[model samples]
Target chain A: MSLRLAVLGAGAVGGSVLDLAGDYGHDVVAFADSSSSAVDPAGLDPSAVHDRKEREGVVGDADPEAVFDADYDVLVEATPTTLGDAEPGFSHVERALGDDRHVVLANKGPVAERYADLRALEAESAGTVQFEAAVGGAIPVLSTISDLGAPHVTAARGVLNGTANFILSRMAAEGLDYEHVLAEAQDLGVAEADPTFDVDGIDAALKFVILANVLSDGKTEYALDDAEVEGIRNVPGTALDLAAEDGRTVRLIGEATADGVRVAPRLVPQGSALSVTGTQNIVQLETKHAGQLNISGRGAGGPETATAVLSDVSRLE
Target chain B: MSLRLAVLGAGAVGGSVLDLAGDYGHDVVAFADSSSSAVDPAGLDPSAVHDRKEREGVVGDADPEAVFDADYDVLVEATPTTLGDAEPGFSHVERALGDDRHVVLANKGPVAERYADLRALEAESAGTVQFEAAVGGAIPVLSTISDLGAPHVTAARGVLNGTANFILSRMAAEGLDYEHVLAEAQDLGVAEADPTFDVDGIDAALKFVILANVLSDGKTEYALDDAEVEGIRNVPGTALDLAAEDGRTVRLIGEATADGVRVAPRLVPQGSALSVTGTQNIVQLETKHAGQLNISGRGAGGPETATAVLSDVSRLE
Candidate 1:
């Protein structure tokens, strides 16, 4: 079951996947960052690649396009997610599928922005696509849905964005305003410097969009633009304080159904399953016959997301 | 993809499975209670069977043993759980597997008490044994473990019993003594006439024992006797009040690892994910590299448990 992987993108998720693939009994035959490529038919040493990427500006001396020419069983798309065209990530998946190679994606752009196109490509290719890492970091949301059968699952909703959740939970616990907490989060490396995608609910919306597409099973296609999204920026500390007075708490909840997707700050009862705190994430699935199922875990991290990617790689035939 | 099912036992789970099987694109060819059975080569009408059972106090005029003679692709073992020998249910499973036919169990005794034997029979048969309904009712606990690959999961801990959880949550919320809550639960039909199995932690222990067996992947066999069990019979309202004063509450928590299984009423943070309220169940899996994954849902019920049974039926090749 060992697979030869050509991993694209050298960020934390990609680097961690390359570093941990060997532990999961997989070999990295080709790897590339935006500007550089490292290719080898035989497995490349992860540490050697890491050391080269650290000391030198590039991962290797080979051209970036050389990864397409290398022998690989799956294309690991871990590149930074783009909004509209989905860039080289989408193209990388197309090329891999065209070559009849499996694709495992950590990038959200190709999935969230262009789900129908991605699936159409998958329909024509012998290779399948799996992107467990694109949704809930380490949580097995997609697989659970698949196991339960998508048609049986009525809707999916919960805390998806860890940065927003962390900020909201911290603000509620400390009684601080949005501005103060965002500053503290940036200083603590919990939030990015710009922080628009993570804070403005786009990140969560994209995930729900992907979920909607999956749940609809190609009956309806969903994109980020179809979602009704609202972030935590306007959720003041006073609103949280009022909620706490009534024995409730606020969480950045994202919901996805066949109809549409919505991400907003909502009040949940204190100590409820949906009230996961800090950097934790949760997904509550409303099933047709079974009652609600809640799955929560570390939603975002280099190693956490990498485990999901590795799990996907292991699931491939 | 339509499967021919022979459902055993006339209890809630078995009845629900018979009632809902046709909706899932499956046909029930044979159904049995202790005294009688209804056998039809062409599918039996669920309402007709129910009507006959209601008026005549039997499912049909046929002998209960006639179920084996009828054609069936899967045997649905929903018989009441019995400890030690785990008979009737175990024998039913053995006969189905012996015939190289698939078996889906809603009964806990065979899985919780005789896991090694069941797995051994499965190994020799062309059919597979799936018992998702045996633990956590409708919650997809076992399937999640299977997807994560049992070796990658370090431990599983949570609230697996609903009746016990309902009593505990009621005691904590109403500030009532254990006796008062037990009486109220009995009046509400939440607790059975004999609540010893649930209130004594044996029910949750059985589930954790099954979880331990699955997580170990046959490396270790766990039985009810192997678990160190403590129930909520001794947890007074005063203890819950004292814990609540300090932002904590008590829950009947169960833990299972490669080492052993233990179930006890433990204190958890008031707003933590583990502190799910009334009749709800939650399982937190400590994974090797993916961090902790929590799955919570309704642990028991007729339609709820039936969904898990039907889900298992759908998974059969």
Candidate 2:
């Protein structure tokens, strides 16, 4: 029952999945990242994995291409958010699938951007591409879709980005302006320094795109560029105040429909579970068959991502 | 890859799974119900499963003892709610697991009443039990617990019951009373003739017991008797009018902690997503590590249950 796992982009999620795979007694064969584009010969040091993070060109001095060279059955992709536009990242996914390697993506960029083509890539290779960690970190969003068959998923919606949620929660709680809270989030290592993807709702947009494509039937996929996204930059501290005045809470909501999708800030009432859900967490998804299905918890981070990746590994059977 | 599956009950979910399994070419050896206490040699016709519904004791008329005696590896328990304290219905689960059969329960009552003893019986036989459809119907709540790992789940909370929710939704929208709507639900065949389990919160209370046992961390055993139960009987129709006056929605909420559990009607803000989640649906599960995770979809009926059972068959690998 040992799966030969090859990790692409030896950053936070990739490293954590490798650790879990080792714990679960899976064989780790290859390791690569942007820092070291060539494959490692001596096998990955499980201990050294936690020391890296994905930046622009590298992660912990390892190149992304190196992780793909190992003779492995499955590839775990944890590249940075290229918004599915990065040539190298998309090529990496295609190459893994072309190699007949089972693909598991943690990055939202590829599937969100070119889901039709990547889905075709899966069929062309006759390989499975499981990416439960992509949409909502590890909230079981993707798996839930697989579980329910998504027939009743009339509308898919949620707080898909933890960084934006953190910003919104800070704005709601501390009565601070959006910029001030986002800066604090970056300094606290919650939001990225180049927070365009998270702040402008692009991150959540990418998630909705995939959710629309993967989790729904007869549902139109949304273009990330076309989504009506409003970042947390201008949300005044008084937003939460107004919500509080009306016994409501403010949350950045992402939604999908038959026609298109929308991701923006909305006012939710106080004492509502979604209103109470704060900081790096998300809640909301109403389905036709199963009623109002809620998936909340850590919207981002390594441990949840690791569980998601392991779930992909389990799907190899 | 086809797995031999024997359905223990020919009720709504069991019959649906059997039809799909037969269509998909899974080797279904026999059928079991109250009448067929023993497994019969000749397989039951999947096509004719529903023809006996009008017969007196539909389950018992199928040769219950004969069904259990048949050679089968996977046993699907899909009867209506029956406690371990009851006869005929619940004992089938214990006997099957005790005999080393891999059991998947869409039936809620057996697990609700005697989870620990059942788990112990499964342990003795070294059997795997899958019950994703038990707690939240098609919602994957159980799998969510498994995906997040046993460590990260602190409390199991959200909207678990659906029949009551439909009543609440009607009350909120049309300004109707609980009893009147209950009568309508029964006429619509959504609620049973005697709606104590569905309307009185006993159903959700039972589901809470099952979830708590799974997440209780070596507590090994728990009971529904320990739970503080509240049905929708106390919720006045005027409450919805008042909530409407204040822009709120009344929802039947179920919450379970390590110490105890409660299922009652609550007044959540009307515009809130929880309030908007209407009719035969379910809501979130806030995991300890993952935060407030939402999963909405159809909570009852044949399609969702059929999908769940078929998905279980797919997971036999």
Candidate 3:
């Protein structure tokens, strides 16, 4: 049961998959960057990760020829999260899944936008594509939903965007404004220069889509295009003050619950998990069996998410 | 594949277990409540739960024994957390396990203090004594640990006691002292009149013991007694204010990273799941394969815990 994995677009997440594959000592087929350097189809050593890093852009440079010719059993999609088009990793995931590669996605694009295609592709291939890393870095949420009893999950909700939560926490605690927090987040590389996805609820919305599909087993209907998106930009420093009026707090919860599905900044009073996690993204599910379950942690950062990618790779073993 | 179930000391949790069982149409045999109503080996009917309120020492007056004797497949131990040698659940859990009946425990005391005896009994019977509902209400953490791919989990950590978390949440928000919060929690029945196990970290320590034994297959060397059991009984408002100064909140995290095991109220800068769960209990686990995972909700309500019992019953089906 040794799997030969070919990782596409070796960026932060892609490189993570590669590093994990190397660490796990799985058989890695080749390195195919779209730029700079490429490995011939003979298969490259996963051990050469350090050397590959030394040659900047040599991994995520995206060389399809090498990727197509790899002796790999699965393709790990770890390209950057493009806004809508699934740009860098979307097409790569489609090709890998189409080419009979069992897919494990740490990338946010493919399953976020083109989930239907991936579902159909998995059905057609009779293989599987696991994307638990999409929402909460290393949370076993997706698998928990799928493998648990045939549950009729009503809604999947949580604080999906880690960067947004940090901003809110700062706003609540230090009384800092959104701009100040966003500037720091971007400078720290925690938020992108164009942080529309993280801020405007798009990222959380994407995760909700993944959860809905998994919880409902692709039969539950959801409206992706009509997601009620709201950013933390409008959150007030006085929101925490208002929360203090009732021994409560404010949290930006992106959820799909019984009232259909929604992503909103909620006024959660005291006596909830929402107020404890200062900057960690906590994802929760409300179902028929379990009323409400909270899952929390650092939803971003390299070590945590990199460890998550490694966990996915470990699943192959 | 029928199981002989005997429910011992039918309280809220025990009665709720049988209530959920009746809904699923499970067969129960010999509900052993020391109450005056137990001459025949009749299965308890969970529907007429209100009838227990009708008479003194009449436990199963709720639903007329739904199933007659000799129909159960297991025994359920849902007694209160007894302390020291006066332990009540100890006898029942030990008896059921010895009887080769699959045991489901919601009690933490008998397992925590007398872990060796319970484990020996279970080993002798070669029967599983499940306790998913023991640790966190409806979280499925124990089951998740049991099902994980890694044979040796590097660590298992969580907010195991809902009452303690609830008290901490009050202290964090209302700036209320621990004594005040403790009294309130006891009034709400969240904590016992003598709330030592929860506030002193004994309850979480007990759950940790069970997890270490079962998930690690009883091979790991870890002493919960040595854990830095810092309770939330003496949290200073100054600490909360200082945490607020740094844009942070405080939470009692039972963490077992490479840094070793500890249970203390740590300062968490906002945007974390711990921060968000104001009074509810949220649990997270870091496993070898799953990385960091989380689960949150009402960790100690009758309905929520009852739901956890239902989850177990569903699995039995």
Candidate 4:
């Protein structure tokens, strides 16, 4: 069951996947960053690739297009996420699917924006598509939904963004304003230089859009525009203080159902499972017969998201 | 993918399975109680069977042993769990496997007490074994482990028994003694007349033993005797008040790993995910690569447990 993988994107997630693929009984035959490519049909050494990427700012000497020529079974797409047409990542997925090679995605762009197009491509190909890493990092949310069968799951809602959740939970805990906490988060590397995506609810919204698409089961296609998103920036310190006084707290929660997708900062009971602390994520599924199912975990990080990607790779086998 | 189901045990879980099997596009071809049995080559009406059982205290006039004579694709075992030897349930499972029929279990006895024997029988039979309902009732704990591959999961722990959790949380919430809460829970039908199985941690211990067996994957076999069990009856109201003042709460928690299984009342942070109140249950898995995964939901009920059984039946298909 060892699969030959051609991984795109040498960022944290892709690099970690390359590092851990062998541990899961898989081989990395081809790898690519934005500007360079590394191809070895005999299987590339992870450490060697890491060393070259660090010292030379490039994975290897080959052209980036060479990845398409490499003989591989599964294509691992961990590239940076982009909105709109979800280009580059979408095209990469299309090429892989067109070749009848299985595609495992960590990029949320294509899945959140172009689900119908992606699924249509998959429908025509021999290879299947899986994107467990695109949602709640290492939490098996999609697989659980698949196991329960989408029709039985009535609704899904959760804290999907770790950065936003971390900021909000920290604000509630310390009674700090948005500016102060965002600055501290930036210093701690928890928030990116431009934290618009994480703080403004787009990241969480995209994950919920993907969930809505999955739950809808091709009956209705959902995109980012369909969601009504509200971020953590608007949640004031006074609001959190008042909530805490009432034994409640504010959390950036995203909800998806047959109706639509919505992400907003909402109040929850202080001791509730949804009120998970810094950098944690939780998804609550309302099942038709099984009652509520809550799954929470570290929804981000290199090794964590990589574990999800590798899990998807194993499923392909 | 319509499966002919032969349901045993006319209790809550089995009766619910017979009632809802049709909703999942399956047919109950045969059903039995301890004293009576019903067989139909086509399908038995759920309401008619329920009415007969309600009126006459039996499912049908046929002998209980006649269930073995019916043609079934899968055998649903929801009988009362027995600790030592796990008898009657074990024999029913053995008969079904001997007949080369798939066995989906809601009985924890055969799984927790006789895992090795059950797996050994499965090794020789063409039919596979699945017991999702045996662990966390409705929550998808075992399937998550299966999807992640048990080797990737390092350890598992959780609040499993709902009756104990309800009593403990009520005591902690209302500052009431265990006796008072136990009486209230019994009156509310949350705890059984003899709540020893749940309150004494035996029930949670059985679940963790089954988890230990699954995580160990045949390297070792675990039974109820192997677990270090401690009940919640000794958790005083004063202790709960002290812990709550310190922003912590006591919960009847169960932990399972390669080392062993332990079920005892443990203190957790008041706002922590593990401090789920009321009858809710949660299992946290510590994965090797992925950080930590928490899955919580209804751990027991007629329809909830039946949903798990039907989910297993779907997997078999």
Best by DockQ: 4
lDDT of 3 at B16: 64
What C-alpha root-mean-square deviation, in Å, does candidate 2 show against the real structure? Answer: 6.5
- Tens-place lDDT digits, model 4, residues B125-194: 9999999999989999999999888999999999999999999999998999999999999999999999
lDDT (10s digit) by residue, model 3, range B1-317: 33445566566676665555554445555554544323234554554433653555565443323312334566666667765642667776665566566777777766655666677788888566667777777776765554444352567766777777778777777887788888988998888988888888777766666555555554443445645678777777678777877878777777654444578777875655556444466566665543566666666655567666655655554
Q: Which structure among the candidates has the greatest lDDT?
A: 4
Task: Give residue A211's error in model 1 in angstroms.
Answer: 0.8
Kindly indicate the candidate among 2 and 4 with the higher DockQ: 4
- For all predicted structures, in order, the TM-scores are 0.97, 0.71, 0.73, 0.98
lDDT of each: 0.92, 0.71, 0.64, 0.94
lDDT of 1 by residue, A131-195 (tens): 99999999999988987889889999999999999999999999999999999999999999999
Query: Tens digits of per-residue lDDT for model 4 on A106-134?
Result: 99999999999999999999999999999
What TM-score should be assigned to candidate 1? Answer: 0.97
Tell me what TM-score chain A of model 4 achieves.
0.99
- Candidate 4 chain B lowest-lDDT run of ten: B269-278
lDDT of 2 by residue, A160-265 (tens): 7878888887787788888888889889998888888888888887788777777545345545875777766677888778887887777878877665778888
lDDT string for model 3 (A1-317, tens) is: 55677766656666555555544556556655556334434445554754766666365344565676666777766667765666767677667767777777777777766777667777877456777677677666665564344353566777877777777777776777788889988898878899887788777887876676566556654545756777777887777777767777777887765444567688875545555454577666766645767666667654456556555656655
True interface contacts reproduced, per candidate: 0.78, 0.47, 0.42, 0.87
- TM-score of candidate 2 against the unseen true structure: 0.71
